[model samples]
Target: MRSRRVLFAVHDWGLGHATRCLVLIRALVERGDEVTVLMAPSPGLQLLKAELGQQCTFYPYPDIPKPLGRSPPMFYAAMTGALPLIWARFKREHRLTERLVRKHRFERVITDSRLGVWSRTAPSYCIFHSLRQIVPGRSPAIERLVERGQRRLLKPYRKVLIPDFAENGGLSGDLGHDPQLDWGAGRLVYIGPLSGVRRQNVPEDIDYFFSLSGLEPQRSLLEQRVQAALPRLSGRIVVARGRLDAAGDQEQKGNATIYGYLDRHAQAEMLNRARLVFTRSGYTTLMELAELGKRALLVPTPGQSEQEYLAQFHHERGHAWSTTQRRLDIVRDLARAQGTTGIPQHATADSVQRFLDAIS
Candidate 1:
């Protein structure tokens, strides 16, 4: 195979995008491709730097302002209000992408949910899981409208690679699977779950593994709530705060061991050893849980419709127990989650190869 110069753009909305991209970027490097990552200044970027080291080039780029609100209604309103600004950012991103493509002579451009990071001169592709954005009300009309809009935004890419199985409705369920949407046959590909974490043969010593992550005040809020309830719970607990800036510091509080962050290897080991996993319902996290077949208590972030939908979907299916952040009772939920079945393990060993083959 010829060594190609590839430019990968990642969305800084959360660490999930960066982590999943890391899997593909590593595969590209292993195959002798020169890869460059374009991203905003974020913890996600820091994590990539720490993991990849000198393996790839890193470019700093500005990202659109995150649309966040304290409540679900406010969040939707904020997204609606930020449309113009988001559009401007998209234009800016495209301009930067074009300049980078010309200057670096990139042979391929792949974006992970960054709508504006594609180049006309290169063979561009997009990695996206959500084909239809579910709203707070689950209105069919609203969902269809949003799906149409998303399809239009994805029209410029040569292919939209979905990191999910083609059969059994996949992990994403209705979020990525919609019979109504027309994606121009052969342009949409299901490449299975692109997770960096894998199950390992290790003793299940950790009673509860809290992998806390997300943006801003909500992350802090969840931490505070968990801290308040920690004294009431018993057993060997491990909490990864998901703070990349902490530089991997560890602290001990009673029976629980807390870390500011856990790199890929450490996190994978913890997941394998944990008898019960407690974390968010983000798609990426769900994929990891599915890969490891770990039972979990899911707490969805406030105002995040997608997470809310996913949590409910899993709970109804008896895959994982879920609750809102405001109503979190760690002790009670943990007990309840133990009785439910965990996510089923799926074959993801060839997911990265499938992606590479599709692009090639």
Candidate 2:
């Protein structure tokens, strides 16, 4: 087969979207295909660039505004208010993708939860895990409507690639495969967990690793909390602050070594050395931990029902321990989180090859 030009549009929700996109992006580049990435300026995209180097072309693109608020109700309210902007964003990106497609002659367009970046001339695939949008409260009617809309919006793509198993034994739990959603046949493909971290035989040395990520004021708030508790904590802990824009600086603060950001290899190396990891319960983070077989303390972001549900799911399944950011006491929670089982290795090299085959 001839080498094809591929366009990858990533959603800058968190670093997870870009991190997951790396697996496929690297695969395309390794196969001698021209891969161009369109993403907003964020830590995740920065990490992607550092990882890929000159293998792919990077372009800045517009991103959807995150619905952030102090509480779940407030987040929902903000999201409702931003519906017009969201609509306009979709239209804007749709037009942008059309222009890019015409200029670059992209043979395939793969989007990581970007609903608008698709072209009729090229085969387009959307990478998504959430089929049903979770609201703060239990509102079945609203959830059904949201799910219907999600299905409708994704129908234009050639296929929807889920980073979870089609069977019930998936990492995404009910979000990817619930009984309520009607995902049409052949339109959905389970590509398994897309993670850039590969398990190594390196020895474990670091006692605790704190991976700080997600949107902020919460990100900053969590950093403050962890900083306060760091002096009391007894361990050789390394904290990756998840600040991509900042200088790659490391500082010693009592028993903790804090880094503004870690490149992919460094992050993987730290994960390998860590006996216990502390981070958000994002699906990509879960995949990374699972790949390394490392235990973690999951602190779900407030008001984000998806992360909350995922934390709860893993906690109940003995995969990982979880707590909300408000109730999190670093020293106390570490003891509780240490006793739980970590995520198991479910994804393999075959999964990656299968994903490449399907996309090709």
Candidate 3:
């Protein structure tokens, strides 16, 4: 295979998108591809730089503003009002992509949910899981409209790579698998779970592992709540604050240890050793849980419909126990979660190779 100059664009919504892309990006680098990453100035970008080092070139690119609200209704309203701004950002990025592709002569373009990062001259692909955006009221009409709009946005990409299994309804459930949408034949490919965290043969000595992540006030809110209840919790507890901006300091309390953040390798080691994992019901984290076959207590971010839906989906399936951030009780929720079965184990060893093969 001839070495190809590839341009990868990542959405800076959260660390999940950046972390999941690491698997594919590392594979690209190992295969001798010249990879250039385009992303906004974010902790995710910083993480990628720290992980990839000199393996890939980094370019600072602006992404759409994160229209997060303090509550669910507000969030929906904000998103609806931000449509024009989102469209403008898309146009801006599309223009920038054209210039970048022309200047650098990139042979392939890949975007992780950045709608405007594709080029007409290159074989462009998108990495996305949510094909149908779940509305607050679960209105079929609204959901169908949202699905159609998403499909239109994805039309530029040669393939939309879903990081999930195609069988057993996959890990995403209704979020990725929508029977109503006409996903063009061979256009949407399920490339399995693109989790950077691999299951390791390590002792499950840690009683609990809490990996906190998500956007804005909600993330901070969760942190404050969890910190307040930490003193009441028992057993060997490990908490990753998911604070990418803060220093990676490991603080030890009586029976608990907390860190500002944990990188991929450190996170993987912790996950392997943890008897019970607790995290936000983000798709990326769920994929990691599936990969490691770990049971978890899921608390979805308020106002984020995707996370909320995913939490409920898994909860209903008896795969994991879930609760809202507002009603989370560390002791009670943890006990309930332990009763539920963990995610079914899946083979992700070939997921990256499958992705490469699909693109090739």
Candidate 4:
């Protein structure tokens, strides 16, 4: 194949989005394609920039921070109130995207969770595991409305790329959810789970491994709460705060240990060595733990319905366990739970390949 250019518009929600896209971008570059990663300037993006090398171009896109609220409805309402800013960001990013597309004549545009990057003029494909926007309660009417937007969102792109198994929507199939909810005929494609690190046969001797990531107050608040309860947790514990500014190193705190951050390699090393992993049950994290064959105690952010639903969804399947951020003591209960996921997979989620293949 001749050399081609591709623009990857990554979502700025959390580290998971850009972290997984690292594998995608590397795959494209390995296959002799010029790739540019356009996302809002973010700590996660900065982390990615450090690892992805200079061949990858960087462009600023919209970045949304986690909102603080008491409930899912309140959180969504707060986020919804930011619609004007969201639209403005998309407008600005889209204009910048157009300029890049025109200047570089990209052969294809691949967007991961970032909508509106799919342009009619250029071959474009969308990569996402979420379609119907997650909401509280299982209302068919709301699902239909979200399904409509999801379908419309699918229309601008040439293909829809999903990063989960085709069967049972991987781990997120249940809970009034359908991978095919808005997926068009022949347009929906699954590329396994996009994973950067494989499960190493390292020692699983450590106790509960907690990965705290969301945003400022929420993240710091969780840290303080966990730090207060640290005295109670038995065995060795590791709490990662996912801070981007400081140097990522290991430190011991009585029986508990804290790491400011961990790149993918260090993270995999730890996950392989951990007996149980704790974190928000986001779809990507769920798949990563599954692929790594690690048990987890999920603590979803209080108000984000997606994490809450995902936590419940996997909890029902017995793949992992879930608890509200408030009742983190359930982690003690989780210590009694045994491993659930059957086996580890060597597969990598090639959403990037599927999108490129679609455009080609």
Candidate 5:
């Protein structure tokens, strides 16, 4: 088989999409394909660059502006207000994608939740977990409209690759498996969970590990909460402040250590060594936790219905513990988190290799 030139684009919503693509990117590079990443100069993209290094090329790409607000209600309101801007950005992304395809002459295009980044010149694929985009309130008409719009947006892609299991009811609950928003058979490829974290057979020395990420004011709000709670918690605490653009700085205060960011290896090691962890309930983080067999206290980003649902879904299933930012009683919740079984670590090496083969 001959090597193909691949162009990959990721949405800059949060670090999850970009981090999850690391698995695919590494696989493509290791297979001797020329891979080029089209992403904004965001923290997630920066982290990707550091991880991929010389294995792939990078290009500055356009991204939609983040919906901003201090709280959940405000966030939803801001998202509603930004609809026109988001639509305009989508159009711009289409033009930019076309231009990149012409210039780079890519043989394949893979987008992680970036709707407009596909091309007719290449075999384009969209890798996303969400089929039904859940909002705060449920409206039959709104749901139908969302489904229809999603279907139209995905039409340019060769296939929508869901990074989840087809069997075992999937990892993403209703987000990935919803009969109402079905995209028909043969349209989706269940690629299992794509995660880059490698587990180590090490002793669990750290009592608590806080993996902080996402767009802020929420991120900042969580940071403040964690900082306040740190004094009350005992044993070694490690905080990986997911700031990719910042320097790799570390600060040690007695039993607690905070780092600006951790590479894939450091993250894996820290997560593996921790007895209990605290992190956002992002899909990628959940996948990583499952892959490593670690349990966490999940605080879903406010207004993000998907994350909120995931947090509750896992909690109900005894997979993990969850609490809102406003009601985060750290000491009490950590004790509660200790008892819940984590999301089952079921992703095998065979499934991962099959995922690579599908793209190849």
Candidate 6:
């Protein structure tokens, strides 16, 4: 392990993927391992550059977003449309991975769900959430085909790094995108939750930050719906607009104030101050929420099967309230949200330590 040269390849779909990788990379560096992060240029990537300056080298990976669409069906369609581009990217993935191995003399390749960012000549591992595909049954046969495709794509990796607990799948169910997919025998390792973010000054008295996800029409719809509904509530309200360029000083509209975008520090400030948070039911967001241990109203984007599943999953666990975004009635939603307790505070330390030990 002397003179270890580790390469971390991260997807650029959302800040979550890259952010999660940041935590792991930080751990690797702390252990005196020299690291190189291979990723696409993203806001999160820029943020990491600022945080991990000079500790590691960065190489660009051909990562792309899944595209933003308002509704789940539309977003999926948009993602489907990117199939051609994705395939082309995958082809480039193998080629780049091959060149990096010899050129950089890397000892390890750690990929956070990137298709082709590792090499055949080195010990490359993939970090991902889904082992089994979660198809909506619209095409059962197609789902099987997609599963096979995933298997084929991952076959070349030296190991598969999964972020989950040893049992109970840690944070999610077992059927679709579950632990059952860990068929790589001793080669598979559950690395717990992967998140590099550390929140400061978590407030115990605030309600919520009302985060707007970076996705498309759903983000706009939430803003409009929440603004329209805020007047009926009797409490402090702050909205994080999700887009930095659209950010500004809080604008008062009735009882609510909105900001275009909040930096990590700003977001931590809002999350700490808020009493009842509201956001979409993305798995990565759940990690952050778990860190905060604050109750929330989660409105999953319509038709995104995974989000829907997570909302319901957490709801059933008494961690948050899940409601469909379109059918949202904020008054009733908040009532249910306030009734539910948030996650345990110990969850954060448990999850982070698991990931650290995986690579240890």
The model with the greatest TM-score is 3
Q: Given candidate 5, what's the lDDT at residue 260? A: 85
Give the alpha carbon lDDT tens digit for every residue of 1-360 in model 2. Answer: 789999999998887888788888887888889999999987778878888899999988879888888777887789889999998998899899989999999999999988889998899999889888776575898888888999988988988888887775588887888737777878788878877788778878889999998777788889998989888989799999988766579899887899998877888899989999999998888888878877889998887888999999889988888999999989998989889888877664656786787888
Model 3 lDDT per residue over 1-360, tens place: 988999999998888889889889999999889999999999889989999999999999889988889999888899989999999999999999999999999999999999989999999999999899888889999889988999999999999999898887788888888558787889988899878788788899998998988888888999898888888888899999988666578889888899998877888999999999989998888988988899999999999899999999999989999999888898899999999899867766688989999888
Clashes of each: 1, 0, 0, 3, 0, 11
Model 1, span 240-355: residue lDDT tens: 99887785699899999999988878988999999999999999998888888889999998888889988998899899999999888889999999998898777566889889
lDDT accuracy of residue 202 in candidate 5: 94
For residue 192, model 3's alpha carbon misses the true position, in angstroms, by 0.4
Candidate order, TM-score descending: 3, 1, 2, 5, 4, 6
| Per-prediction TM-score to the true structure, in the order listed | 0.96, 0.94, 0.96, 0.91, 0.94, 0.89
lDDT of each: 0.89, 0.85, 0.90, 0.74, 0.84, 0.74
Each candidate: RMSD: 1.5, 1.8, 1.3, 2.5, 1.9, 2.6
**lDDT score for candidate 2 against the true structure:** 0.85
lDDT of 5 by residue, 1-360 (tens): 688889999887777778788877887888788999989887778878888898889988768877878787888899889989988988888888888889988889999988878888888999978877776676777867877788888988888888887865677986787647667667788878877776788999999999998787788788888888888888999998877655488998677899988877888899999998899999988888888878889999888878898898888888899998889899999999999887778564645686676776
For TM-score, candidate 1 versus 2, the one ahead is 1
Worst 10 residues of 6 by lDDT: 173-182
Q: Lowest lDDT 10-mer window, candidate 1?
A: 172-181
Candidate 1 wrongly placed segments (more than 4 Å): 245-249
Which portions of model 3 show Cα errors greater than 4 Å? none
Worst 10 residues of 2 by lDDT: 345-354
- Pairs that clash in candidate 5: none
